[model samples]
Target: MLLELHVWGPAFSLPSIDAQCLATMTYFSLVLPKDAWVLVASSDPSVSPTNELPALRSGATWVSRFRNIVDYLRQYSGGEWDLDRDLTGGERADNIAFSSFVESRGQSLVDLSLYVSSQNYWDKTSPAYGAILQWPNQWILPPKIHAQAKLRTEHLGLSSLDLEAIREQKDREHSAAVAAGKIPKTLIRNPRETVSTLLSKTSQQNQFRLEALTAEFFEPLESLLGHQPYFLSPDRPTTLDCLALAYLSLADIPDLPFSWLRDAMRSKAPGLTAYTDRMRRHHLGLEVKVIDALSATSTSSTSSPSLPWQAPERASFATLGKTLYDTLADSTPILKHIRLNNRLREAALAPHSGLSGKESKAVSAYALARKHDLYLSIGSVVVSLAALVGYMAHIGLVGFSLAEQEVPSGTDPDPDADIDAVVDAGQVGDFLSML
Candidate 1:
């Protein structure tokens, strides 16, 4: 029987690096025959029992979640790629613990970076989702997904204590305060104020917690991966390798909004980065440019000439728009300038070039529209500036009129007079004059 794996579609001009998607890809690469299973990428949630991506269906059996899917596969495939075959009693226990840690703590960091970090989520991640969706769905789904991810991240908490722990701590403090007669019971903070305070406090604390946990998570993994090509095992890859590689590849992505986690891994856990790069090439069969930390130069290696899982060529308007947006938003000054110039040159050459009549017309129209937009933007700015100047002049005239009314003979003025009210009256006069 053929297996069917449903995952979130690729976007952002990149392959799917979503943790679960990566895990699914990793599992498929390892155990299943290349043609045995079909992979489906879509945004629809109805396909999965849990309403999540990376769900697997083999015959009538349905499995969701990376670990659960892997366990089921292990049973179904008869332990063909099971890493636990060689593990000792202690090693098996350690593997389970490590997997749980990565799923909870490590996964939280990835979620925070991709969704909670404003720059990454808005500029890159959300737009990626929008690209995969149709017009009305694009308008609606991205925000909903973003909101859901953020709420999940918030609930996960910054430290080990989490939101529940913090709430419990607050309750304990309130009880102590009441016992000590520090304040009246009636003066206890209401639910609204309690929630407000918790949000305010956790906002900053969450960032600090992410930083600390990110470092803490990688330290042990790096040590374990040292000198060995894979974590725990020397020859064959394991489930832990799949989970670690999923996250490491994501963090290493160029131009990600949150770089602190990536930078930490690069600086403090170079071995982990190297290990992931090797796995990505070996299993995924893509040529990744790996930068040597000591030499500070990139070394390119080809795992396979042809990749089975490569995404098909995308040539839609959404793809073009996203490409332009990313190019324009490039932080590097020279690259941005060059990309913009190249785009303009392409637009100019399109009508004369060997493009189809429809393509030429589309390109020409886009260029003209963009030019008009630039002109309108400049005009709007000029008009805004003129209005601002006129308003400032009106304010000055009102101030002068108020001064004259206060001291007609230019004597000492009353210091206690409400100057703010006078200013408001002047503003009213200015508005009336304008009318």
Candidate 2:
């Protein structure tokens, strides 16, 4: 079977919208032959058992995440697919260190630029996702991603970047002013509060903090890259290169409304920026149109001359139905708790090698909760169906009647008895009374 790589759909002219997905694509392009794998911009994480993108499927086995995919390829192909096969022991150590550093520091910077910044998210990033996704998914995924990004960068203490929060604060202030009879009710927004004013209020301190964070990440990478074509060597690229390319490309390439990260990359770390541009041009194809790529999958023709880009595997109807149910559950307060419990259970059960007694019991409890959720779902469906049938019958769209009493033994059935009679509003109570 062909190796299929499922990832988030394209945005900002990149093959994959997500940084991790792009890194996984770059790694596969470098290591595997063009025919060895196909790219599918499914943009649907539900396809993966782990519910994440950049998931790789080889026949029946499925692997998820960038590192896990790399590890699987190495072991499955017996080092033939290892990107760092030629690296020395010391170089490998450097690779591990830098990859972790990029994930932690670089990831934060990207999150801030793309998702935490309300202007960029609403004006550019969120809309980009909407363009790739179908109806309800377009509605669901972007906000979920934004919420996660907020949680991830909460500790950064750069609340100035979150204009939405600032706006809410301003609204509260405006409310207080109105209550105190200080401002006219006709003035909805605070007359003095504009985007420029908001930024001006916090620019100096926030810019300093933001620039310092960028320098902390970029200065090290700039020093390491120095005069080399790649991260570790002048000629060869490794897993570290893939990781660096993912983060930097996302930061540098996208033309967001607020581009603090991009501006910092250009001024402070020109070398890394250049590297990202060069690698992107050479390895990743110039532009990715999700619909065209997906359409290409049905034909024998190629979408790109260099990379094997195809549509992602289509989700089954069952999967779609399950997603709808899950979406409903998430929207509901009680079911949302069950969904959270299921996720918590999965996290608890994911690590198979070492399980303390307490962890094992937690896993069991989670399993029980999952079972309860299943029963609840079934019960809900049954009740919903019953309600639907009853409503249809009441509205005269459906009809039900008991078998006629054994009147034939005593006399012929009455032709005047209209058992098929429709119930009218006035007679509904009488019909119930007769029953």
Candidate 3:
């Protein structure tokens, strides 16, 4: 089948690392057919998340609207996760490529667009999406994650589509243009959205949504393992893994120490501690601090630790779970990739087919784009590192600006002329099978 694989990247993979997105994208990329129209909905299309922008080549269509994708998906499969049912090999590969770019929906803490885009979605959903959700009262079981998808539909009100007049009004200005697979204008980080400003903007409903999700969806699951200190079980991982993954992954915000429950991790019965350590080594592909930062804090600093965020077992069981994950899931791949470091790694760069000559006129344009990518990811590493170890020069944490110009070593093709004839298969293959 000629596939119209539409991606409504409302909250793309670039925002965080997500498990389902990882799994689904992997399976799809490895198995889906070629020549599929992979429509990627990004608030900004010019900003490529996959790193392999490759000038859109011949297969992909980047876009930016949630409803547009809903309409597209309606053309293929319907609700309740029918995405990976029976896809071919090429179809699976494209899905993996798309998935590899999704941002983790779970804990992309500063996702301001989720708030700003509502200024558009709620203006459209008439007859009320809430009404549709309530039609089946028996299905009113508390939703898995934040469950904000229900209320947010009001944001996608039918006013835009003019459901009553959609068929007749040819010149209507509906938000469904987003569904057409074109990038819409969206602000990445609302300049006004400081940590304090964002906290203030959080509606009471958002608080309840988060509270309910934490108390109901996440806590009980954490409760299952008793008051242990870690989440991993034995030598293998469960299908239900990735729940607390972000809580640790994003804990790199030094000013804000990690606050996951410690007792559950420390418990020896089910034995979570060792498993967590091992998973950090395996899945995350990064080093994790297993020892409680709180204990380390008190012992290391004669100066009392400034922040109030200790592990849950240290005091009252204060819960902080994600409401965004359920809404994004398979929908936005780029944002999911951003949430996880799956997008981060050193690899041999591929020459874009866009290059016409040994030194095409487009070199300047391409260099600028490469510079932007370096700053966004690699530059962030320096910016996040405090001046407590300031060794060089420039902006906020801007010591190594020119250092990025260096070509990556061990990856230069000329260095190894002997093994150059075969088609190079990248991480795409290995990443797909894992899903």
Per-model TM values vs. the true structure:
0.54, 0.76, 0.23
Determine which window of 10 residues in candidate 2 has minimal summed lDDT. Answer: 296-305
Tens-digit lDDT track of model 2 for 79-133: 9999999999999999999999999998899898999887788889988898777
Candidate structures ordered by lDDT, highest first? 2, 1, 3
lDDT of each: 0.63, 0.80, 0.30
Model 3 per-residue lDDT tens digits across residues 39-101: 222111123334221112223532212222322333444532233334557654644443222
Query: Which sections of candidate 2 miss by over 4 Å?
Result: 174-192, 297-304, 313-319, 347-435
User: How many clashes does each candidate structure show, in the order listed?
Assistant: 0, 1, 87
* lDDT score, candidate 2, position 270: 89
Q: Which candidate is the best by TM-score?
A: 2
Supply candidate 2's per-residue lDDT for 136: 67
Candidate 2: C-alpha lDDT:
0.80
Q: In candidate 1, which residue pairs get closer than 3 Å at backbone N, Cα or C atoms, i.e. clash?
A: none
Tell how far residue 402 is off in model 3, in angstroms: 68
